[model samples]
Target: MNPFLLQTEVRLASKLIMPLKLQLRQLSLKRFRLQLRQLKQTLDCT
Candidate 1:
């Protein structure tokens, strides 16, 4: 229950989470772009 230890743990957790969040965001953005491209192609075909 030491405050310093708690702070350190939070800092470490955030450091680990930041990259994962960035990666997830990038993945979702790529997926969205792919879907958009597919939609445009379908529209063009019609």
Candidate 2:
């Protein structure tokens, strides 16, 4: 395989992966926030 081709493929893969990483990070943060809210509600009720 050509070196340039390999590099290009790697760059494309990284570009694709970067957005997924950002989305996953955002989702995890949202989930964390929800969990904190739920915990606070439970504590308030108790």
Superposed by TM-score, candidate 1 places the C-alpha of residue 7 at a distance from the truth, in angstroms, of: 0.1
lDDT of 1 by residue, 1-46 (tens): 9999999999999999999999999999999999999999999999
lDDT minimum window of 10 residues, candidate 2: 1-10
* lDDT per residue (tens digit) for residues 1-46 in model 2: 8999999999999999999999999999999999999999999999
Q: Candidate 2 has which clashing residue pairs, if any?
A: none
lDDT of 2: 1.00
Predicted structure 2, TM vs. truth: 0.95
Error (Å) of candidate 1 at residue 21 is 0.2
lDDT of each: 1.00, 1.00
